[model samples]
Target chain A: MPKNTLGEHLRQQGMSRRSFLKFCSLLASGMALSPALVPRIAQALEATRRPSVIWLSFQECTGCTESLTRSHTPTVEGLIFDAISLDYHHTLQAASGHAAEAAREEAMKENFGQYILVVDGSIPLDNPGFSTIAGISNLDMLKETAKGAAAIVAVGTCAAFGGLPKANPNPTGAVPVSDIITDKPIINVSGCPPIPVVITGVLAHILTFGGLPELDDLGRPAAFYGQSIHDRCYRRPFYEKGLFAETFDDEGAKKGWCLYKLGCKGPVTFNACATTKWNEGTSFPIESGHGCIGCSEPDFWDFGGFYEALSRPTGQTGKNAVYGVAAGTAVGAAVWAMNRAKKEEAVRGHEKLTMDELNREGEES
Target chain B: MTSTEFLLWVKGTGFTLAIAVFAAGIVLRLAEIWSLGRKPDLAEAKGNANTAGVRTIFNRFIPDKGIWDRSAFIIIAAWFFHVGLFVVIFFFVPHILLIDSIIGLQWPGLPTPIVDAFAVITMVGLLAMLFHRITQPVKKYLSTFEDYLVWAVTFLPLLTGYLAYHRLLFSPDMLLAMHILSVELLLVLLPFTKLSHSFTFLLARWYNGAISGFRGVQS
Candidate 1:
């Protein structure tokens, strides 16, 4: 545990009280808290000692790490790191070989049952050799590290929901961090590479409250994942108005119509993309004239094709329709033939003495 | 299953089955009607049956003046419900895409707010119609279980759709799945119930007009 409080550490690092308060306000807003809570967050964060964070990378492409490094304004690597003791991250840590492993063990031992464990990749269960850190299998490392963690933050879709590696024919038997460590409170920041502020926001919430944030059914922080992209989308009016871009180069596309026809998954995908946006509030995927691929949702990779609309049938609809029409035609024709035969039979059986028969039938009745 | 998996199932297998049943039932019913050809009239024709039949298809949309006067509320409510249903089904972007996928034709849809307003109107109209059916003594006697069943099925799609669009009561995926499943139910039930009148009413109108035309009377 750090000796000085977060405010003292930031002050020592040349950060003013006003700037720290501003950062707290940003964090409070990012966590979906009301403006009134900003002061409480500031007070809590200023007085609290910085928490120890142990970041572990397993079967990942380091996109999560890259996203974090590029996080908004205050710069996560610069300010957040200054606030927390990121004891071990092989990519960012200077120590290599045994030295890096020693740092992780030291942090775990020193901050036993208090450190925050942030994992950014899935764990491979097929074979220990598939993924190893310093000769330790991912599963073994996760199990060992989770024992001392106060809480765990699964930082990406891979760590949260067994992302691409666990997609269709999951060869490596890849599983998420939650699958292996269910005993601890797990906060899933799920996305192909989750938004930058979301990551910091979650961390800031933990720092301010000294506990995990409220989560959704999927174990994601409800503050960020509460609303879907479609609900907050700017182009939603176009969708409501029945205006869509049939093709990428169409007039609707040029006019920035809804991308539902182009297979936008905003309706089902829960994320802050539409509101928080990406790259310093530049724009999200939908704003770039491309439909959202729903990277944040679980098993997004296996939800048929990316360009296929959410309402479109996943099966061979055309062939099934053809079969339906053929069967219908056959049945229709059969019924038609039967009715025609019955009519012809009646015609053939018609008697010449119809009037006399009718009189006789009437008399009998 | 997860909501997404449920959504996929409804969009895939459920949709296919509903379409097949709807298609077969429609075709079979039409074939049965066509095979029962009308007997040729021995009397000389006073007017063109074709012209009269086509005219009635459009003209029957409005009820006779005396009937309208006696039950103007019912007539107006029924018309609003129908017009609203038509606008929502044909002018909504998502519904249009579904239609285009099946029929290989596309048309520009009305704005979303317009369609949404129309959907609300349709629901209100349907409710008024139902109230009239239940309270009006003659209509209540004439109504059958099938009438209420068809009404429920039609109302479900609209209600579920509105809820899903607004993301109410449930998760977005769950709401969406329910909306789609409701539509599937409507499609499957449409052919077997009095809802088949959507197609059969045209034939009935034509027949009535043709008979009137043969008698040299305006219908």
Candidate 2:
């Protein structure tokens, strides 16, 4: 068996090479690309040596790493480690303390301007006093490390858009990496946990293309964040019929009615959750009967309170939404009232004119 | 017939009727547009009789203005909700399932949560719209008898759907029955009531847009 080959690796794990190829084909097609593109992808991947990757953790819960590295997680652990020569990661490295730090420095020096820098959390801008890696402030460490990187992949919403840390009255004044670094190309892999395939998919694209794939206006890959979740939801029929799940665990929810009324940010949000999905495309938050929090977008936290239905959010986002409903009703009524008044006024004017005309006719007769 | 079979039959009939009315309403609205200028002299533009101001309001629709005034939430949000709602309904999971089973076209289902959230947004937006009908000034003037009934008719099914899902306010089965009945009523009344706006709006929008475009007026 060929060593370090993708097909052979699949076979060693009791998986068929055919199944892996089919999955690649599926993924390719899901991005609205031709299945024919698979062979080229396979060839590029087969020929290229394992690219160096450095996974950096900053002020985060390690959820993004866990999301990417766990076995049971989608785009599983086997796929991630097998795909990249993950030289130095704070969480997955075998080195301890200074050794781990040395390993990262060594990796950067060896793979200068070649390694992919995957940062998974926000960096504190508040005096850089809030966070440090290896005793160096996160800001200093990020700049020092990122200076030689070929591309930076900001994984998770926190790293991409400052996630919850940048929410109202931000305490740490945490900011996304895009705020500081301006030279290198950066891609935002945004989600609360940042879906697994999205992380790996970015790697796969980078490996295959030898650079970043096209990104949207917001720096998210268009292949992943091109469409709104609303455009591909299952319960859309229910919405057209004006059916909705007003509360959690409602009958409409069980029946899979639309959740737009429940403060779902799917409409304003652009993401691939509805299409690519989590859990191997089996289901997503909306499919599981929860409304979207617009987690993938920038400043999602400030849109409105999370967990409150879109209809009833106390904040401006929700207030504006309610205002929309009320305005629709009021304008609809006012149009009718105006129509009715116009009709009545027309009738009165016609009657008075008829009386005057009748008197003239009588005099003439 | 057994209740299940009978219910299916009723649903089938209701769908047929909804489509029928939907089609007829389109035709009538088209006829209305066609006849707008039946008399050349009577159909003059509001500003200049020589100029045909068919562009009046409809041009704001159809291809769309992309974005409009911030204060136009009722119209703008309504457009999103209505456009989004129909796209979801006609092109969503269960609808596809129903269509495939009834008519034999098995398309794919939309992703779950997206459609789910869209429904909730539509309802909230619609309800707020109803409140606006009862509350606001200019909108109140524009409302009609059918508009009020349209609001109630559509809201019942949405509310019942929530009720059936949670078994809140009503038991599951009862809420289910209410939901079905409300949908059936909505369909039956669709063409007759202002609820016809769902279908008519598209034609109305297009006509306004095309005519406005023709007249070289800003929509």
Evaluated on the second chain alone, the candidates' TM-scores are: 0.96, 0.65
lDDT of 2: 0.68
lDDT of each residue in A27-123, candidate 2, tens digit only = 5654456788998876776566667888888888888887776524444335646767787788888887899999888888988988889998899
Q: Name the regions of candidate 2 deviating beyond 4 angstroms.
A: A1-32, A71-77, A309-365, B1-219
Itemize residue pairs with steric clashes in candidate 1.
Answer: A240-B112, A241-B111, A241-B112
TM-score of each: 0.85, 0.53
- Error in Å for residue A295 of model 1: 2.5
Positional deviation of residue A266's Cα in model 1 after best superposition, in angstroms: 2.9
Q: Chain A only: give the TM-score of model 2.
A: 0.78
Error of 2 at A141 (Å): 0.9
- lDDT tens digits, residue span B65-153, model 1: 99988999989999999999999888887787777777677788888788889999999999999999999999999998999999999
